[model samples]
Target: MITRTFSHLVLALIVFIWIVPFVALVSTSLRSETEAKTSGFWTAFTPTVLGHRFSTHDKGSTVEFIEMSGNIFDRLNGEKSGFLVSGEVQSILIKARIMNPDKPGKTKLIRKLVPAGEPFETRGGSLVFQSNGDFTWTFPEATAPKPKKLDVFINQDPIFGADAYIEVLFDNKNVPNALISSFIVTIPATIIPITIAAFAAYAFAWMQFPGRDWLFVLVVSLMVVPTQLAFLPILQGFSGIASWATALNAWLTDCEINDSCQVASKSFPSLWITHTAFGLPLAIYLLRNYIVGLPKELLQSARIDGASHLQIFTRIIIPLSVPALASFSIFQFLWVWNDLIVALYIGPNNASDLVFPIRLQKQLGTFKDQLHLLNASAVISMIVPVIVFLSMQRYFIRGLLAGSVKGG
Candidate 1:
């Protein structure tokens, strides 16, 4: 029991360690850029710190007082010899420099505290008064003071923790459009490979033909190839395809009466193709193994019923292979959703065609000072994957565990 409790504590600690950064990330994202820079996210949650920092009335140690200087008051013989004191300060600290007629080179400071509700009298060359921050400087004598003017600067000390509302701003309008573009690129990229691989996997598992096993081996072996080698060649090929497509688009635009052609030289379709090509090997490998393990009796029963291959696949295999399909779909979706390299190669880097991943990265270079925006964009980018995984997690686990154990 003790061991079990210790193990749980360890697990909880690990989970907490993993969770803190994300909590910080979320907190950072929720604040305005100015707020995020001054303090960390954890500070927002602590009531003690908040109360100490932003409370206007609290004279706590954590609070920083701001010093404000008022207008220089010139005390003359005929002048009222008074100036208005600002703010709700209980006490005023004054520094007054007076020119001495006796010693022309010497200046004297007549500094004193004038507590609230008492009038400040000018002593030689100084004045002090205090109020609920409305004090007036007065020279008791009618003659001009030794110094030409007495300048007073006031300081207001403030406490922290007043603002409870933190607005997480994702004001970059480009992000939502880029997210839509990512979805456009990802959903099709995920679905197309799965659809194509499912057929190939079904054939590899169920159909017998010349070189069939060899082909399955070849397909599986391709998964071993590092994607870096193919990236440049694939990009080159996509550029050529895009060039041709652009030519066709230009022709269509020229032929049209209303010539508002917003055709891109490259776009989401190319990204989908690149992602699908890169993702297919894994899809086929996982799906083939799962399909191969499905009972042969079911395929035989379907065959005996005169069901066509396509019909059997659509009606029988797909329904039963939901777990495997879902697993691969999640994998491909996340891969394409988060990929910046393939999207960069195949799609235009401009805002018109950039995906969310690329959009978030653009903030680093083009708008690095917008730290809050980057955090918010990152959080926004993560939402779909989180939702996808959460919704399909059961199927993902079931798929992994499907052939792990057998009763027979």
Candidate 2:
């Protein structure tokens, strides 16, 4: 009983660890930038106090005015601005900094909470800031001060929406294109390898051939080899092929030699072939292990009924092996979908062909401060793989555990 309880506790802890980051990621994606940055994701559903700096209108040296009147919320840039929001602020704090006359370029900052519906005094002025966001500033001097900006902090309910997703997905051309390009790259990369491996696995399991066991061992042994070791040789091979193709195309067409006529070494076909080659070793290994565990009577009965190998494979093997195929499909799909190094090395360099990982990586460098958009992009990239896994989850365990035990 104690051991079982301990095991359940461990599993619960593991689940919680996995869930926290996803919860935070989703929460941060939905929140306003200010709310996301200012407070932890735990505070996303609560009222938040957001600080904003707004530049006041300076009427210039010629215009003399002791007082300035406007609504503080008027400075907010509405929905277009990532952080700024306009509403009736129930509580507020005002902060201002003025240059010290004694020290050039040095300033002192003042922060004070305003009484409800009452005027607040500052070092530079007396301010009446209301919950409705209206404010009046009367300066001690004859004219408004230099620099002409004030910081206002207001408390309000958090803003939550799909606005971040909209900006990340539709507003940015790279993200949307990268998404489509990822699907294009991943789908073929997955199917071609599975198709080829299924035929190979069936042969290794059922057919008679010279050095069959030795060849199966050789393929299975390849699963231990790091793909990085083959990169240099494979890349050189691709470059050579592309160069030859480019020369042939140039000779065939009467156009000047340029990228337009040059074959891209990192095209979609190259990516599919690379993924297929790398995936085949494991795909074959898994499917062969599972197929070998099937009832021999099934195959013999088909053979006795005058069924050929191809007929038995298509009619009997394929249908019965759905669980194993689905299992390998999930593995291959996720691997290809999430791959970055392979994409970065042999993948397309053109803007139109960049995958989600590369585009997301570029966004990391370009929009380091835009966490909201980054989080949204991360979530978007995970959506397809998650859907694929969930849809095929029932078959995952059954297929993966194939050959581990035999039925009586």
Candidate 3:
């Protein structure tokens, strides 16, 4: 009993810790601006609708009540008099009534008895009345409008649907731009580092060289350096390169004969170079460790067979290192995809050059009144990361042992 209880407690605690952040994010995303400012989502169930009472002033006269439901502007749709009545019909009393001319025998009266003490005021249209008795009614201003009902897979609350997700995803323009910029940085960042590192790793493991240990040590030391400290200098350098490119463009445009050629050649190769530089040290270290652990007999036999270093690397080492490479690629891709700071510093922020993450971040600021779109954007930003993780999971599992055993 004690063991079972302990296990249950552990499981419950784990579940709670995992679920809490997700719950909070969802709740906050669902809350309206007014609700968010006034109270939390926990208080959503409290009734927000208001009520008012309407009574006839004339004694001994019966008043018929009718209810109408539609958009506020639709109140005037079928009425003979387009004018809406509001404010006090007399001192200390307001009147609200809807006109119904269809009834032949009796005068039709409509009064909505809302929650008392409601402070909303009607606008643009009024409730018309053809009552025998003088009547008074009071109402509060309309609350925020609810979304149209949608029925899909058990009627998900509008707050939890695509709209809400988009709002969260695109809440900031920087977010989407960041996502795209991450991809731009990651794909080449992963490929360039791995390619160079593979060659270096092969040489370090197989080729005898003076100061190899010292060189490896230098590479590893870079990993310990704080990335935050390096950011400003890197950013300044990138800005200098961009400035140079702009100057070059101005020079090219000054030459009328080849202005179009210069415009066509304006790609920022520096972006890729920066990512590769930042990623290279780690890549070389990881691939070197994996390559050095390969079976020496296989390499020796290849040498005896007169295979060149290039041939051995291409035919043997490269094929064997797929799992390690795949794992590293996934990591690099995700790292770049989620990066906003690096993209902001390295790339242009104008519409033509804006990345997906940046676009999502901009959307977030404008989403105060557009909850649905915000939710959709949130979901869009999450898609690539989720897909990448799922696709690369197998390689990650397999790559753990790539460098662990020599020939096991």
Candidate 4:
């Protein structure tokens, strides 16, 4: 009983830790700017309305109280200069003003307006003018008013619905493009590396040749080299290719082959080559180990039956190594798909060529005011990674032991 109780407690604690951040993110996403600024999301359950007293010295203490649903600025919709009068006051006038920061006594009137018996509409909140010129704003009111019900829309309040997902998928361009680019980069990157590496791994494992062990060791050593060390060299190589392509185009105008030769060009092709190069070392190492572990009897029997190396590799080795191949493909696909560093470095910096991460970063400005959009963008970026992880997870476990033993 004690052990069971302890297990339950641990499970509950783990669940709480896991859920807290997600709850907070959801709450923050749904919270209005005012709520986020003033109180925690937990406090939102017990709501409060802002109350303002509208009165003037000339009005002789006939004060009007206004209950508002939201922040003060929201109630004064673009009108800064205004006298707080009784709701019964006809021809109510209000003026919008900005307090001068440099000059204390001076007020700059930005706008003037007459109360139209309607309050300004904002997300999750509404402004209502009392019979006196005093206006009160309310948000998600405890009891909605009767007769003419006021609908308050508070912007930036946390919503507990699937709207977050919808907004991320449809509204966010970066996420979608990132997802698409991931697929584009991943599919070709995975397929090309696996195809080439499978052939190389087969030769290294089955074919006897001088310096084979040394070559394999060198390839494996390349794996330990930090990827960052190659960045500048790769960049320079691509830049050189771009330069060569430009010069070749100029020369093509003078060549007889110009009519038949289409310029075999694009940064994308180069990026594909780069991904293949980076992926090849690991792919070969993994597949070589798996292939070398396969039964030598199968290859010998196929050879006695007059099977060429090509025939044996194609017919026996490939059929048996499906798991290893699948596993490697999954690994390469996911790595290439989620790679922002490579894409950013190789991709064109312009909007037309910008990948998902760059586009998401573009949404976030240098100032704090752009935080709402930044939050929205962050949610957008996570969608593709989630999808990729879910789709490829099965291969991880299923293929690890594949081709290691003779029988399944």
Among these predictions, the greatest lDDT belongs to 2
User: Each candidate's root-mean-square deviation in Å?
Assistant: 10.4, 4.4, 12.0, 11.3
Worst 10 residues of 2 by lDDT: 78-87
* TM-scores for all predictions: 0.68, 0.85, 0.61, 0.60
lDDT per residue as tens, model 2, 1-408: 999999999999999999999998998998877677778888777776777766555345466568877776776663365545765655455666879788899998866665547876654677677777777778878764653466666666677888889888777788999999999999999999999999999999999999999999999899998989989998999999999998898889865744467788988899999999999999998888888888899999999999999999999989988999999999999999889999999999899889999998999887787788888999999899999999999999999898345321
Candidate 4 is scored at a TM of: 0.60
Two-way lDDT contest, 2 vs 4, winner: 2
Residue 122 of candidate 1: its Cα lDDT?
42
Q: In model 3, which runs have C-alpha deviations exceeding 4 angstroms?
A: 1-182, 239-268, 369-372, 401-408
RMSD of 1: 10.4
In model 2, the runs with Cα more than 4 Å from the true position are 53-111, 121-127, 130-150, 257-260, 403-408
How high is the CA lDDT of each candidate model? 0.66, 0.83, 0.56, 0.61
Which residue runs does candidate 4 get wrong by more than 4 Å?
1-158, 161-178, 254-266, 366-376, 401-408
lDDT of 3 at 244: 72
Tens-digit lDDT track of model 4 for 262-372: 333335666688889899998888788888888888899998999999998899988987878877877786677657788777755545555566666665553244333
